[model samples]
Target: MAITAPIATINDHSVRILAWNQIGSWLTYTDANGNSAIKYQFWDGGTDANSGFIWNDAGSGQLAANTTLEINAADLSQVWVRGGAAGGSETMWVRAFDGSDWGSWDSFTLTTIPNSRPVATISDHMVKFDQWTRVSNWLSYSDGDGEAATRYQFWDGGTATTSGYIWNDGGSGQLAANTTLEVAASEINNIWIRGGSAAGSETMWVRAFDGHDWGNWDSFTLTSQPNLAPVATIGDQSMHVGGWARASNWLSYSDPDGDAATQYQFWDGGSAGTSAYIWSDVAGGPQAAGTAITVAANDVSKIWIHGGSATGTDTMYVRAYDGQAWSAWDSFIVTSQNTSPVATIEDHSVHVNQWVRASNWLSSSDPDGDAITQYQFWDGGTAADSGFIWNDAGSGQQAASTAVTVAASDVSKIWLHGGAATGAETMYVRAFDGYTWSAWDSFNFTTVTNTAPVANIADHALHVNEWARVSNWLSSADAEGDTITRYQLWDGGTAGNSGYVWSDVGTGQQPASTVLEVAASDVPQIWFRGGSATGTETMYVRAFDGIDWSSWDSFTLTTTA
Candidate 1:
């Protein structure tokens, strides 16, 4: 008989034997005349004919005529057969007799198969942290002779092994089929996971037994999963030529996987164009892509930078690392240099009637190295609305408050004449680049008054018989070289009182010339004559300039006989 065919089957309340009936009837029959007949006998021994079989005759109470029997193929011991199969191989023998005829011996064979090994699979092919996960059994099988059981092991980087890692009872580290395993990941870990399985094999060389013999161990590998990268955020930033940005005040970095940012990178000046921009560590220098920074988790830092001798708006960028990978770049701005000009002045003092130049007094420069495009001047004070002079016609020129057009650079050495007034005068100036203006500068100076001239004359007397000359003793001078334009001559009395008529010539007086005569016009000298009963005559003289007159000088004369 074939091994797949059943030698015996038990169903309902009866057992049916197919192969046995083919060999012979193992049954007893009864006829209407109350006589009993035997067809076959039951057996429990090796294959050897009716001697190896046990017999139960009809009407002898040994056989129940058609008694029911049960058998179990899964458990060969319950088959009620003799001996047992080795390696799922076994043989049996039986024989039956009909009344007076005997049948040849019949035989039956039995075979049983063993169970197969189990396979393991995880619910998530890429297992990650921060969530509960299960390692379920998938496509696992068992042979007809056994059942399957499974266990798991884990490793950080590479494949897992039984001896390499200790197996827990389906807990945190160890895992089993349909069981859960959770691993918490933080910034401190490098985060790469590999899962291992020990299917049907918990201990060394030991397999799971399912009411039968043990099975072999089988394992599988799961895909590796890594942690997430960090995120970097940049805040608004601004800096002057000599200033720096404080990282703590302007940047934020974090990770979604509960990890801390391990490093920071920076790029300064212009655009952060692709890979052309070199990245630098937060602590120092330009570093490679994977280089570590000196900053700690959630810590603050500073980025020092200069204007680099350049001006105008500039840009900067930054990024962070979570020990495993780098985050996307974040951008900000770094303004460099300036355009406003600075102004300075030098004070001066001038004597009255002197001239002062304005151009040589003030100077200015731009911080950004820009050209000094424009300049303005204040006459008396530095008030914004004060007297300001500006160029109105040329490039970068402007009109002053007085609406007067000034030529570019016409302000150079502009002369200022000091008047008679003696006091301090102020002049303020400011400069501008093309974009911005500078603070006002101030200059102060003083003007002094001029001295006046003086005249002198000596007293002289002339008798009626004697003539006197006064030109040698009369003179006038001025400290400022002012010319003596006029001279006046008069007596203590009016012309009627002296009764002497004097001839006037050469505008009444000339240096080193004789005085005019009273009666005659031919001589240049003046001669005093005695009047009727005159004792003495007095005369006064003075000099006059365009703006002032000298002090009067007087002369006395007596009549002589």
Candidate 2:
């Protein structure tokens, strides 16, 4: 990028901006004005400054991690600038921000998810992991010395997810304690471990072993919780947990007095604690256990509880959001009691109740207490489900709280709605790329929302030929109370030059004119009107071989029939 003039001022600067999704690099600048750009730059850095501007590397500073500079505005006016080159793969992402916080938090990972078939490789005594593709997964030298008799295991629901993944010492080799046999992902979903080499008792160090970094990798005891089928996904620098979190401080306490929790409380925010905000209820009712909630794309969180009370009468709530605010009593359900109330999240149709992953339909549930008895998937709104299933069957019921593996093709536009009865209903749609379920659609209503839902539509195909009679038709609609009309223009095909006035090209429409086509040597145009000519009639500029439509840009058609 070539910089003009000796001084690039806020008033003068032009550039061809280069942008790549989230991150962009601009050959931007700074103004040596009343404010020391650096001091002033850093000054606004923490204040009201925008992160999008840093892409310019404005003599102000270097690009920070997890953020984009805000240069599109005059805030950085004195610092004249424009688009430049493209950044790296880690361009588009989120950085943490607070009205009063650091130069900006190290961007937040909106979706913490599980990668499909996470892979693992036994390395340096640790288990290294890898997701579907990018990002390595590995358990560094923690428990072991990175050597010897290491038995790697890739499991699901507690058994070897794949044949080759479950490797045991078989009392053959001797893996040392803390030898840290890190593992990397293989052709499996993911790799975790219960290895104490000498003790033989399984020690849990549960974290996605991405070949690169382990995000808040958690460790658990295999004895208390014997089985877990979790999913982890690595996006940009964002790592997520998709599987059910088997542990919860909330469930750890049980009142011997049976008085129930004097108060039910939960605080959600960064890392579940940092910058956390609290929510509590004074023994108003039973408290649900576990912090491990189902976090769908866009931060939608859900969980199933089997021990709120004995009777299965209370509502089964699934919490959700778009980008802001959380909903109370979002999901509902009805079921009996069973311990293994599996709550799973899958993209490809996973086995639920007892069905494979198909774009048509899939589901999740709590095996007992709040088992899934009904299924409803929304493509942004109730109107979007293809039939009733996400991929096929649109309506049904079951007895489990497991992920409904929607046919991969039916993702993105669909949503997850769970409820036991009807009063307290919880449901929200998420954004997907037909592969991974990223975040939930944040757009939701405050009360019993009846906002018009967005319809997922395939754009209609429009075509024309030399002997053109643009017979165009589109299947779209306005709100239940509104009308949407369709129109087209060849502009006489001067590429995009002519404007022979558009007219009524259809009948039974607001403008009652069924005049649709014109000959090769003729040109016709049409439009609609409400209170004129014939109450609601189609105005036209009839058969113009080469003539002005009319003084008013409209004319009567010379009827061929």
**Strongest candidate by TM-score:** 1
Clashes of 2: 125
- lDDT by residue (tens digit), candidate 1, 180-223: 23322111122123233332112111123333233454444344
User: What is the overall TM-score of model 1 with all chains considered together?
Assistant: 0.29
Screening candidate 1 with a backbone cut-off below 3 angstroms (N, C-alpha, C), the clashing residue pairs are 115-143, 116-142, 116-143
Tell me the tens digit of each residue's lDDT in model 2 across 512-547. Answer: 333344432222333321221121112332222121
Q: Evaluate model 2: give its lDDT.
A: 0.27
Report how far off residue 539 is in candidate 1 (Å): 25
**Error in Å for residue 124 of model 1:** 16
RMSD each, Å: 27.2, 41.7
List candidate 1 segments past 4 Å from native: 1-226, 269-302, 337-428, 431-561
- Tell me how far candidate 1 lies from the true structure as C-alpha RMSD in angstroms: 27.2
